[model samples]
Target: MYKATMKIFSGTDTGIPNYSCKTSGPLAAIIEGLPTELSSQFSSLSRMYHYPQISYMSGNLFMSDTVKFPYFYRTVPSELHLCTGIIKLLKFFSWTWVSIIAADDDSSMRAVQILKDGIEQNGGCIQFIKTFSHSRTIPLEDMVNLYIKTSSANVIILYADKRYTGAIKYMNVLQIPQKVWIITAEWDFLSHYSLGFDDKNNTLTFLKTKKNIPSFYKFVREVNPALFPNDSLTDLWWKDLCTNQCPESIRRSCGSNEISPYFMHCDTIHLGNIYSVYNSVYALAHALHNVVISDSANTTMWSGESQKFLDFLPWKLHHYLKNLHFTNALGEEMRFDENGDLSIGYDIINTVFLPDGTQRNEIVGSFNPYAPLGQDFTINEKAIVWDSEFTQIPPKSKCSPSCLPGFRKLTREREPLCCYDCIPCPEGEVSNQTDMDTCMKCPEDQWPNQKRDACIPKVVIFLSYEEPLGIALTLIYILLFLINAVILGIFIIYQHTPIVKANNRSLSYILLISLMLCFLCSLIFIGRPGKVTCLFRQTVFGITFSISLASVLAKTVTVVIAFHATKPGNKLRKWMDSRFSYFIVLSCSFLQAVFCLFWLFTAPPFPFHNMQSETGTILIECNEGSLIAFYCVLGYLGFLAGISFIVAFLARNLPDSFNEAKYITFSMLVFCSVWVSFIPTYLSTRGKYTVAVETFAILASSAGLLGCMFFPKCYIILLRPDRNIKKFLTKNSK
Candidate 1:
């Protein structure tokens, strides 16, 4: 206690025996490195003397208790800020699993509790907490061996003082590399005592004050041995290293050795914690100046006994010290918080070994508690020089890598949520970025692409005339329609010819015209569907086929009745005229027209757009509004063809000259067969193929009727004109 007291107040001018000689005024003391035991002893004596005591390094929790130490204060921050800054640093590097090493003392134990609470609050877990004693009860070699064998944690936070140098030496003996060592403000890793650890590339030290202090450096260089003879730092100067036996030439040459190799100049050394001491002195001086100024205001004139007058009011400086706020000579803001501690800002230093045997600290990042929440901790990753093994990539301290795009996270069953596997998005859903929690659905008109990373537009489809199938069907229809026209023209030119007038010329003309219209109606099914074409296409197809089938029925009845009326007692001869055949054709055709009218007025086909059947496509088609009504039209046409087929089959073996019944029966058979297959094929197909099937059926059935009924007669009229005479026809009719 006597030695510490002399170091605090007594300089070369005042000896230990005469320390009470200059006691004229109230005085404040700035002390450094006060342990808890010494701080308690000093606080008791300071309270008894009524003088304020400010500590620069002691961060024990008891110093914050104003009731116990009323005059105690500190310029450095408390342990809470140190723990918070460490927690922030660990979280920035994603070091969730870590170990704790603290000294076996009450102050360090309290710091461990504070650090545990802070680490857990930031979602981190401590693997273990190991304590070391100053008495060396447990060997540091055994502790380091345990750390080497432990694979659970790669980060170790150490909260011990500089006296525990054995931990560093043990680590150096084991040659531990690639282990991250986190240190607090108390441990200066760049000091010469810790230089034995070769792998300092992974070491990070948190510091309360910056390493460089320009004003302090200038003050150190201006110190002369003559001015302050007993200054302790005078031995550190190279000028004091000269020997008295050295000559003048050698003495002048010795100037080269005056500069420090580490600091590059004689005055500048690594001023690690000395900045805190400088700030402490400035704080005490500012408070004392406030006291002197206040006292001089009440006095009439300046007196030489001002120090004596201020001695009577020693406790008055405590008020000014509580509220002292000023910028120090180093240009740092000097103020205390409500607990009489400075608001701590930490510099994250990366310790690297130089090419020589010395180690240097590089400032790579910082942690400021006064900043906003997320912006408080920042690091310059590019400026950092990592370990040799980890220079190509950053060290992996995370539980899992980040999920890539087009994938989502799926938490594992028995693991933490942060440690999970990535799963691809489901069908019809997509995730465009990395680590998406949920996938989104695409719109109805769009669909997911192959990779499921984006949505693309759908294609539109319809039966069009530009396709090959449509073009072929259209050409066949045109060719058959032209043949029918030529056959009609030939018959009209030879109106009196035997073959033209043999099988009812008017009915034949009507059948030819209806067949031509049937071929033209198929064009509606070839192109894109519209309202008008959908309404009229099916109706026109039904009505025209009905007309042609009625003509065949009338022709079949004429052949049967006319052959039977030539008998002696037959009454069918009276109904064998052309008018009866005409009435039969017109009445049957009119009934089909009425059925079509009812279908049009009640329910009809309309244009529709189908979107659901196939993905990534829209189908343009016709929707049969009333399916029953549409089937009724086909049923009625089949009825007409059935009646005609039955009557034509009965008279197919009559006199061959006037027997057109065989042609009608074969044509009706072909028509019925084509339409029967059309129903199932049209129902089973989808999109553009449905319309193509219906169009093909219409063209095939029409061509069948035209070929079976009219082609034979045309072959005889144009190729065999002699067979058309009355004598030959009478011979063939017998």
Candidate 2:
């Protein structure tokens, strides 16, 4: 739509009948004399001076009503693409009310019709349509008044031609507060200087096109390069003919003209046009090339006969042109619909002018295809001309949700963006504990034990004996054992006189063995329970008491022998040797071990049974495992203590020389005191701590045996031992 002067500087030699390049050449010179008329009133002048005599000479018509010039296809897009795009854009922006400016011309009126239809179809309303005449001299003030008076619409769509003087006059006023837009073919009118006024202050915005035209052209070339193959032929022929026919005054063809200064801000539009022109020429040339090659290859060369060639020429040429892609050039895809109108990728141009009043380029910063009126998209300014090349089509929407075992997808809308679904994490698997988009993995040592609706706490797969309370109690027992062992060792080493050793002779060894066993048992139990030591735990308990009770039995026997043989000629003194005490303890241990083995062979350990509870399942455990083993352990302990009590009572009146005789009685009393209270504590405890507390009581009782039997004897031997050492040493030697 840019205005150009038809300055014909030369005329062809039409009177002459013969020409050197007559066989095949452009007929511009011979056709310049033809007459032509424009259907649109804007071109009131005949505009026929631009025609040439060659146009008539070649029997070519200068666009009669039925024969539109094929070379000049309209650069303006179809109303359909624009309307559809505007509807989408409006929807994207959530704008529903639009104000429209309809041009008086047929083309502009049709475009307005399309815009209105698109808006309505997209669930939007056009509040009003303002009509304007296609006057060559419309006053700017009048347009401004019209715009200011209109208030029903949030968006304005102008369908005016690009004369721009009127638009510029209205736009420059700065008083306008509303958004302004246009769908004009010639966007150069918006260039900084095109409107014959300061357009910098203009409120006009645009549905960007021609923005990425140059980038599109470059992309086509990179993707496919053989575009415009016959361009050289056109160039050479035109040059030669112009040289021969025209005066030297007009050297530049239409191709070489400097862009108008009015298009300084419209670089993308200019580049897009250039690319479109290049692609058009490339597509035509490729079609011609294909037709020519195909004809030559099939024609008979012997007699120079071309019957088949001519017959197929028109058909082949049509076929080639119909499907020609010419992919190496922008706007080169030459596909036509049934109506013979080409559908090209939509592009927008924002025109700008140069200093010499020429439109040189479209504004690269703000040109692209008009997406739906309000759709938000980023301008690819790197090659503003390529912005529309990345345009994406909206995808189809689905209605049904694709639900997973532990998840369900939720939809926000009933249409386009319905593809997204919300997912819920299963139980034992956490959703973002903090705010998050989706579910996350469960905590360590735990898993999604149930449905993934929520994450529940998990128990360790293996039993844990390393709890804080268990560990603390275990340390306390170990410390007590160490303290008692140190005291017992001192008594055994320093207070080893026959008197003290004779009283509770085996108690020291018994405590050492039992404490060592207690320490080892704790270590075995104080971690994750597994298959290894769990089965032997009950048997180990039996062994601990067996050895402990046997030590007490030996002590009681020693005391009995001392008191009985204190009278003249008693045989018990002869039998009261350390070997006899060792024999008694060994016999008792063998008996306990035999009973334990018998029961162990009778029935062994099994998986802990569990019963259903309100929260989950409660595990059932039996440390002694069965009644038989329990009774056997208790009976052995009672028998040992009973024998000790009897022996201590008999020896109480025997001699004051036997200083530890009193401790033997005290040892029996303390052992009974701690152990007798253990049964009630054990029965009341819920689970494993019962075993733990009982083990502690047994350890305490063993400590008491050491304390009472050795403390006084240790005092006598180490501090006040001058009275008893000689007598004790002689008694031991005898």
User: What's model 1's TM-score?
Assistant: 0.64
lDDT of 2 by residue, 1-734 (tens): 11211222121333222222323432222112111123221122212322211111011112222234322222233444555555554555445566676556555566678777777676556656766653532543565576534554435666554443464445453234434343444333443433454222212233323323445433432332134455754334233322322223322233333222222322223322444344445555676688768767865455434444543444355566545545553443355433222344333343333346553334322322333433433333332222121222221112233344455444446432323465676444544332233566655434554566444544322223466666676676677667656756766775556544545545666655674575555555444444445566656766776676677667766666766677798877788677887887788878878877876776654445333211222333433456676677666776777677677766666544553546677888887878788878877765445556665775677667656765666667667767445465334312
List runs of model 1 lying over 4 Å from the truth: 1-169, 172-187, 190-195, 203-211, 221-344, 354-360, 367-378, 396-404, 407-410, 418-424, 435-439, 464-611, 618-676, 704-734
For every model shown, what is its TM-score relative to the native structure? 0.64, 0.40
Residue 675, candidate 2: alpha-carbon lDDT: 73
Whole-model alpha-carbon lDDT for candidate 1: 0.74
Q: What is the C-alpha lDDT of each candidate?
A: 0.74, 0.49
Clash number for model 2?
A: 59
Best by TM-score: 1
* Pairs that clash in candidate 1: none
